[model samples]
Target chain A: MPTDFELTIRPRKGWQAVDFTEAYLYRELFAFLVWRDVKIRYRQTLLGGLWAILQPFIAMLIFSFIFNRLAHVQSDGPPYKLFAYAGLAPWTFFSTSVTQSSNSLLANHQLVSKVYFPRIFIPLGAIGALLLDLLLSLGLFFAMMLYYRWPATVALLWLPLFILVAVLATAGTGLTLSALNVSFRDVKYVVPFLVQMGLFVTPVIYPARYVPARWQVLLGLNPMAGVVIGFRHALLGTPASWAVMGVSIGVSVALFVFGLLIFRRMENRFADII
Target chain B: MKPILEIRELSKQYKLGWQRLRKAQNVRELIADGLTKPLRMLRGNQNHGPAKQEPFTLWALEKVNLDIYEGDIIGIIGRNGAGKSTLLKILSRITSPSNGTVVIRGRLASLLEVGTGFHPELTGKENIFLNGAILGMRRAEIIRRFDEIVAFAEVEKFLDTPVKHYSSGMYVRLAFAVAAHLDPEILVVDEVLAVGDLSFQKKCLGKMGEVSRSGRTVLFVSHNMAAIENLCTRGIVLHQGKLHFDGATKDAIQYYLNSLSTRFGTGHVVDLDGVGDRRSIVAPLLKRLEFFTENEQPLLEGLPTGSKLKIRVHFDLPGPTLSFNVGLGFNNSYGQRVFTAHSMFEPNRSVKESVGPQVFTCEIPSFTLMPGEYSVKVFLELKNREADAIEDAAKISVLESDFYGTGKVPKNGMFVLEHGWYLEQAADAK
Candidate 1:
């Protein structure tokens, strides 16, 4: 038989580029992984996918009581509940993506060690599974807007870009941590701590305007800060923070590049160690 | 004709203590190592210097070369840690090699594990697609063969049921069914046949044979010598991370068997102290195993069929008195357990309240195993718990003998059973 598809295996040198073409070829596998996760995420649970809506919804109610009523935080023109829901939806997506993807490789260690596929799909598929949850939470946010009689504005067009930023940020952190978790194992413990601290640091419970102007750039470096603020500006017609958004996009891209580098460098060692 | 796959000087080196060193340590040890590093450097300890010292390493595979032709069914065999798995892992691209190169001319899918990504919560139908995708099948290809896979697995009634609910046999059948549908130009399988029932195993072997007959290459790694002898046209033996032998299947199997006998000499008393391949969690208690004829003589040449065989197990009991049963299993060269003799199965034969060095003798009245080399497995069980189990503890060869005194030896089956035939006249004939 004549040779049609040839593959050569050899020792890999330092810091290689991600094989985008190969990853693209395995795109169906990526879809299957995502679909599997989504299908089974709530199979035996009593609430099924209602948990996806209830998680952020319940968290929003609690934040509305604690931060709005107890702490007297400003909602920046929208109702405290609406303001909190907008921020909570995106925050949930971002945090869940980070937490889930960080452990994705370890959870699927069998697939990692026993079979050959683009391992990036494990973490990426984890993030992809949460898109449904994000959509559900966003649906509740829009419904809340209807309850408040808030008009749907053209600025809503910017929602997809902010969601993309959140996804990229999650992917960046997820790939790096998942790769590290394979080796260190301590990353598993550290990931929850980091995500917990991140909830407070990101502008989820409070407006970005409340943070001192001097620290706004530092806060924007968190990546999700701009996402939350962007959600408010796009959804509630609040003032846009271009400085924070600019800083966030740069940080998100840099983290993604750095993560891709680390992940690919550690890719070959996963089967040996994991 | 050009070879479909070519490998040159393949090697994989692993650091021995790297995992230990990389493991998270307590803060005190971290501080101590931090404080002593510069002091050790100042004292001129060359061992601590990264440039002067090299971490301990073991080469799992070293400088192996081969050219595999199309339609060739190659069986790879080796003892534990002999690098057969490492070679397969490298070929499967699960792990990268430290050195060497391999050139493949077609799509190669490896089945290092049968159900690589089967989720228990997913339905059987869902897992089929997920497992197929993980094994590198395109979605369209799986869709095209979905009905055939379902029929082959015989799980049409439970296609929508979660895989966790499937019986073990059904699960293995479904997993292997999806794998059998894979139509890669080259297939690499490792011990997947160890699962499923006998009939299913035979069916899988038949499918593999069909695959090879279609002019696709296959690289198989298994410990079952019978399967290798039955299926493979060529065989490769790896010993201590190097290619020990590669030749025709029969010769390769013979060479491997000879190597095993040499490693474990055919002596009367086979010491178990140095045998590391034990499946025991407790301390090593099995000390020695000896085989003898019924007349108290060592059966050096081999045990003849129909003769009585005696096996003695010597063990040490370090703890308080405990009841335990010693069992011996006889497995043929195919790695199939033919029969087992357990002391617990015999009335009033259990050893109770035993401590210190002890010996247990098991006498088989008549060894009816067919003529073949069989490996013995010894296990020490306390009630339902296994205290110690060692496979391949000793080897016994059965020689052909006329058990019926008719000068005819039965060599067609796994065991020789006692039977007699007599001519009978029918009433109509009379």
Candidate 2:
């Protein structure tokens, strides 16, 4: 028999039990969800899983042409392809996660109002697909790094922590928007605009050094700001800063916690309102 | 011994719309009473609940409390929105209660929807693994019962086929197969068996009975009384989100049926409580519902075993006919509609047309229904046939006796037939 119990590691009243162990136990399911998301994305189409690889690659090419050629945007040291691909890595993950997770609730509305599961799974599943796509795109990033003849550094070891930070940031934003999407209903339309606006507000096309030091911490609070900076430092041989990574991790965790609390509080109202 | 589940003082209160409306109404009452009228003035103009205002709010489920011991098969019975599904959802931990503490122990799994978590792009075999994992089953256990699940769902041939390619029936079959095989200490299901025709229903019900007999706790929600009566040892009746009755299965069913009769006197519906003061209630009953026989005959006496009895409920709505569904059930001498059919899910009709009144009929080709005393119960729905339910416009019957002796004829079929004219033409017979 399956285990009947999955207690939250720490369940507080009004607290959303992230149920990490429950999530961990459900890890196989999570992986399958990622796989299913990949399959579903390309299942019935003329252009199948290619969309996963094409989405970020095409976006990178456009940004490379427009910003690198037309705008002559600064890439600290590496080639424009390397610069754009690095930014595309996490940005693609973040943007797609937000898109999928937000729509996840409405898409799974049939499952949501009928059966029960950790609702966080909805956004998590949405992100799961993004992560799969990210992994696929990462393959291209590796091929480019080799073409540029940039030897990997130990800083690359720190990449996992930065990805974790990206996940937290993505989850934090996704949770807020998903729950909101169920309510105001218009968040469905607004999320795309915000994501588009975010591509600019973030330093995806530019370097972090361009921003004055006085504004570093505030930018760090953007959460993904540190992530892009961390990725550049890790694979591109840029200098890493302990202060920035620490501050960003702290902000990411805070966003995650805050997002979780608000989601649990509002989730009770979802079935009725949605 | 601890009951498998316990619910105490559970009450869920919902805001109809604007909090301001409730506040304004409260202020009106306070100023009239002259008690705490000053306090009402201080908290002025703030919305108490939602941002919008509506005339009324439905209490889906009110203060309800109950406990279930381990190994109890409890059936929840009620009309569409009477909170049967609400209670199951709360129990399944899908949604939290606005007010109430539910203490449940042991592992929980839900057949609430077969393949609820199934992904369309995943193949049949992959979905089994996916389903088991989601239900908290370990890989080893799922593998052990892998063949059993596939054989039961009867989709072994399409194990590798993407579920998106499967027909609706195949989807349900595979989904139900996985849910049934994944063993859990407690299993919760809600009307999934209603899919895949009645033959499949009996097969699934048999599986549930087997699960129940194995000492696992089962919580079921369904409007089908015959299925409930056959499968559940205990009954729970939820009306307007409150527990109206909780006891023997027979008693709970009786309570539910009686309530329907009281609110809808015989078949007349439209109980206006209007004090004869309003212009007219329009009694949305007779204008929408009626009974007929297969040969275009109006129903007078109960149809014989081989005759089809049709129920046509005609409704004229404020908008085009979005959906017109009528549910008919076979009620025994005890006044219960045992086996019910609905037009809301007609196999060959356009379920989505528009808004308005339309004539909906459930045609039983030859009421292969048992030869027991049966009544025809009619229910009309609009938005989602189940959501927009009209329980009043049904017909009662003092059906013909068991001439074919097929009533209560064991747990085997969706219909009962009065077989006649058995013959064989062969040279050996001469």
Candidate 3:
């Protein structure tokens, strides 16, 4: 016999409840959505998953030309190629995931309006698809490290923690922006500008050590700054700043929590507005 | 058994103005309002009740109460803006109410539309699972019923093909098939059957009937009164965001029909009220409508069959009207539109663009309406603007007359056709 559960619906009087259990129950749908996005992303492309590697690779070449060759930007610790690649890997993942996930609600408005599932799944699935690209791009970073004859270090194990930091940061901003996009569609226009501007401020093309010492902590407030620095520290054995990592982690977690709060509150209005 | 679902004082309010702003940033005002709302509430500067202070507020559903029992099939019937869709959306949790509560005793699956989450590039097999999961079916359950669904939709050959390649009919068939197989304590369907052809529609209705007979509750919403009367044990009528009637299907349909009958009465001129507000700044407003005979006599109540008919529509324009269209529809007593005539389609016969206080009259040389009770609906459209329509604006009954000059009246269909019968005798037989 099928199990029965009672449901009561009323006007939302105050702050909304983020039902973790309900989200857990829909884990299968979450997995399916992620899988669907991944499959469809590369389905028609001739290069398929190769585009993932090509994007950051091409960006690395341009950064190497412009920042390293033309401007003579100091690597500060590692070679410019290795330094730029490390930052680009995490940066690409964060930017792509944030941009895609922010538009997830609008892209899947059909499902949002027609069915009842945790609306969080759409953006999360978008992030999940980008995770594949992140992993693939990380492979190129390692190859560049090998070409530079860089030795592996125990710090490599800390890479997953930074990856977690990146995920949290992306999820927070993505979910909040996605919810906002449902109501104020200007988020769609705002996101591209955000990605472009974020690349310059995020220490992707330059190292954190290049910044004046006094402003380093402020740079850490940009969540991607810490993830990029942490990735370089893990992969290239660069100088590590516990203070900056702490600030970056704090900012990412806070952004995530704040985004979640705004997302949950705005979720009920999505179907009506979108 | 106790009722499976109970709804009390359910209402939904919507803001109408912000939706018109085509740009995405316009929603920022609403967000800003929401952000500052709490502080205002704390300071006692906000209105306490569910009072709509905004001029553009629309009460899509208002103070609606309903209860559904197990093994019951309830049909929701209403006009275009009568809140049927809003009620379904609230019930399915697609949107929440502004007040009151709805309680459900068991699992409910709402097929507000078939194939809600279908991806065009996905193969038929994949879409089955995807759509099934979206509709609240478990993977194991969808797998178990996969063969049955494929057979019902008759798409076994295209199982591996992407749905984008399938014809529209095939798509709808497969979508409805997957939706039909969902096993829930209650199912809510909204006009999904209107898409498919006749045979497919019948098949879908049959499937719903089967589901209902298996002791599951069903809530159906449709504009088709015949389908509601045929399948539902109970009927609900909503009018202008309020529950007008709820009872047996027969009585509910009768009540709805009675409401249509009251829209227009036996008079030469019908003044419309309660249609809608004069909201548009540029569009012309329909001021007066009248019916007449060929000799320009005021038509009242009944008109003889085969008599010439004329209709005069008076309009009030704020300024010179530009590229406007007016149309009329005739429906039988059963709430089915028989035929419609529009000025847009007959540009040569249409009225010229002009300013305020203008009357446009349409003449029918031979009115061939069969003897029966009928109603008229008026529609007005301005160039590149949303059309305003008032359904069942006037009611006129066609009286029986010797249209054939043989003291007999044609009693079949909605209208009569002029034709002559020819006969020949064979020479051999003679």
Top candidate when judged by lDDT against the true structure: 1
Off by over 4 Å in 2: A1-18, A44-50, A151-154, A212-217, A239-247, B16-55, B263-270, B274-430
lDDT tens digits by residue: candidate 3, B1-430: 6678999999999765321211124467667656664554444423332222222467889999988998889999976668898999998888989988999999888999888889999999999998888888888999999999999999999999989999999999999999999999989998777777788989998898899889889999987777898899999999878999999999999998788667654568888644552233233377778899857888876899899888988776544556777788887654557778777677576455676676777777878888877768777766645335666667778898888888776777668888899888967894
- DockQ per candidate, 2 decimals: 0.51, 0.41, 0.50
Model 2 DockQ vs. reference: 0.41
Tens-place lDDT digits, model 1, residues B244-292: 8999999999999888786465678888888866655455789898888
Chain A TM-scores, candidates in order: 0.97, 0.89, 0.97
Worst 10 residues of 3 chain B by lDDT: B17-26
Model 3 agreement with the true structure over A37-154: per-residue lDDT tens digits: 9878987789999999999999999999999999989786778988889889999999999999998888998998988888889999999999989999998777877788988789
Predicted candidate 2 versus true structure: per-residue lDDT over A136-230, tens digit per residue: 88788888888889778888888888888999999998998898888767788898998898888778898877788887777777788888888
- What would the TM-scores of all predictions be? 0.80, 0.74, 0.82
Winner of 1 and 2 under DockQ: 1
Minimal lDDT window, size 10, model 1 chain A:
A1-10
Higher-ranked by TM-score: 2 or 3: 3
List native contact recovery per candidate, as a fraction of 1.
Answer: 0.88, 0.41, 0.73
